[model samples]
Target: MKRRNFIYLTGVGAAAAMLPAIPVFGKEISPEQALEHIDPAAKKIMSDVALNAARSKGATYTDVRIGRYLNQYVVTREDKVENIVNTESYGIGIRVISNGSWGFAATDKLDKDSIAKAAELAVTIAKENARLLREPVKLAPQKGYGEVSWKAPIEKNTFEVPVKEKVDLLLAVNDAALKGGADYINSILFAVNEQKYFASTDGSYIDQDIHRIWPTFFITKIDKESGKFETRNALSAPTGKGYEYLNARPEDKIQTASGTLYKGRYDMLEDAKQAARQVGEKMKAKSVEPGKYDLVLDPSHLWLTIHESCGHPTELDRVLGYEANYAGTSFLTLDKWESKKFNYGSKEVNITADKTEVGSLGAVGYDDEGVKCGKWDIIKDGILVNYQAIRDQAHILGLNASQGCCYADNWSSVQFQRMANISLQPGKVKLSIADQIKNVEKGIYIVGDGSFSIDQQRYNFQFGGQLYYEIKAGKIVGMLKDVAYQANTQEFWNSCVAICDQSDYRLGGSFFDGKGQPGQVSAVSHGSATTRFNKVNVINTARKI
Candidate 1:
């Protein structure tokens, strides 16, 4: 299928899923070849070559990164394997500050001569571009550890798992979906491993091994007589974990009125079966009534809202209008943050931007730059507090150090400010989903993320979900279809009247959150408990369209 058609069918979040064949960014390699590891000492030698070359070329500041990226994908239909892919990319990227401007160059060749040539080229480019600089770039001070290494706490490296095993799992998931009532089903397992080594003019050398996995499927149910159909997508969240994420445990399953929700781990086979059943129910569900009502949003559903509204708006680049060409700028202007009293949400709403949360996609020992990673409050007790900033932008916020949120999708890409794991902190008051639902006289409970659209400014928006259940007189009455909600970002957050406590808190995220001019993707997680918004607008999507 065409790439655009594939993306349209599966949502942009799973950009790599169900493709006939993945575009090879690097050389196609066998799964066994992916297991081979390069010694950190060897990488350090290559990095030193670039660092010295750039300094010799009159670069005031320089950093070198040696990256080895590996990916594996398994795609299956109802009973057959559609595709199996394994690819590897190895390269060195050198960044330099010369003549008060930034320049970068990358080369796939790792030899000392090639590395030095790339470094000198970077410096030359910086000097040529410096003529157009309005002002010299100012970077925040960063104190880095001399030598350090960080690895994901993965129980099993996905590359080590045989391709046959992954194929077996996905085929079984597809079979379960078909057996459960799906007319058509598509399943995929995608795994990524990034081995990165960094060396900078600053006294530091950093080595990091990052791993991520996503297991998902799409199931469709049809009514042959009516020529009507309904679909359900997997509720799994892309996570920065190993294959162990698919090893769902009894405790990982949370039973609720709507259905079973998963936490850190997932059961792909069981979820596919549930999706098959849910799709059939969706086909027969009644259309929702169009009106304002209280809304209870599951974490699986709320994460996208938080990502589009809260996460994007607070990006330092977007706020500064640097992203105006692509995703547009944010409504959360610098002046609002300067006022310090601008209420961004209800008092119960607390949001944080973190890069250190365990199991989060953005979790890292240090950012793409050499700065250490940590967490900071973005919204505190309803007030705007901070924005995600990098080293170059830290001084604008009057901070001495970066928040450690910089990243580049690949070694060939230039590193820039990216969103961290932005999450809504759970309520302090003890509460359960059932208890929270009991207080809502009239509401709709939304589960799983779906189609969403927000203004470029991340203000006004509408969002749809995978499943919608109506609540009446504090009890779930029945399922509802053609459901979506709309509201301004600030107004919606302020209307949050209740949040279930920590026990119900869960994470939902995307493996590909796109940004920048050339369009780079980053993985991020958003955490929240079941939350309630009062008197929000709910629309019947069928009638509105």
Candidate 2:
């Protein structure tokens, strides 16, 4: 069993307590020091040392990854600055295949001697562990792009942004919440930059600079006399961009009956103000009656469902039972995929996994395994068509190349198959959010992610949302609280009755998604338009909890 904090962070809400401590491999750095970048030519020289050493040490294949990961966090509660963190991790990890087995070693020491020693050790370990191999590792063929570089299309690097600017923004957000009658409020701004260089015997030299940022907050309102409280979380999605993501524009805001939803850019201050007002409404909202009702799920609310039920179950490793740590094996067995007749969802459900999507957390030019990244379909016309796979497992599906879903949280962690940007494709038909909702006579509209529970097999599940509104007679009637819906994986997807077109599509993502035996966290985005699911199960969570 994986004995660690498996709960990943979406926003600073209930799961905040379970946030895992980020393992630091290097010394803490100042804000200015975080902006320092290593020259790719210098990294190439060091990488050549390891690759040559491994080849001389009798390794058939080898790869070297030199990484410098930087992070900055600004946190505040109410009007006080709680904490600020700036850290950097720099290291080199070598992976080698020898005697038909794989082995790995990592070190923070970047000198030529250290790199060579690590490479030799990796080969020695691989030879020694060859006895335990069930069969030779069957790696699919991948053409190397000689000396290529990729960088996230960020307008401004977050590390370059002034620390005081971030602090002020978060403080203002908290102030807005407090002034709006919130009993308590906490806000945070987190940013990351990954400077990575990869070299392999496949004759590929890749340099990549990746950036990601998330701005979030939590607000609570307490009715002191009744000893009851309500909470609201930020509706911002983490994106693979720089500080520019927080620069919201007028067109970026989507006006909804429930409130304002952000698209590409986010208005953090406005969101905090709306959250404060909404929390007050939540405190006065009526409890939802337990019964079947059509569910109108916004992208913010549906992303978590897609991540847990659709994304996790389709990982090639999970389907084959090789991955069973944080979450168990999939209900989507290999037989079902091979048959090509498994109805994973309704015809309205067409899911695609894209690693090259702009502004997505998983966007990358090339995967860790030196394979070019692109998009592929996971569910087409309601059938299980494909899965997220890496270089080693591509042959299982008769694939020529990997889907580029491989990632490692840190230099010390081994690269593995991780989810890409798994998204529910927008409907081809031009359907607006209003049109989709008007057709639902008796329904509940859910916005923003909330508490979620899924079984080990990724089948049975229950999900709650941050905001719930009752819909009657083709119109929103009032707010409802204590709302949760339960469903099986197959049953829920088949109930997908309608989906909005591209105009309403948006993204919601997790900045920290945990997986693997040693447990490495990867950030991924899930995109979708507003969708409606027909009559299903609704429960009163107030009575249960």
lDDT of 1 by residue, 233-258 (tens): 89999899998999999999999888
Output candidate 2 Cα RMSD: 2.7
- What's the lDDT for residue 305 in model 2? 98
Model 1 misplaced stretches (Cα beyond 4 Å):
1-24, 543-545
Report model 1's TM-score to 2 decimal places.
0.96
Each model's lDDT comes to 0.89, 0.89
Of candidate 2, the 10-residue stretch with the lowest lDDT total is 1-10
CA RMSD of each candidate after superposition:
2.9, 2.7
Q: Which digits, one per residue and each the tens of the lDDT, describe model 2 over residues 420-458?
A: 999999988999878877998999999999989999889
Assess every candidate by TM-score.
0.96, 0.96
Instruction: Give the runs in model 2 whose Cα sits over 4 Å from its true position.
Output: 1-25
Inter-residue clash pairs, candidate 2:
none
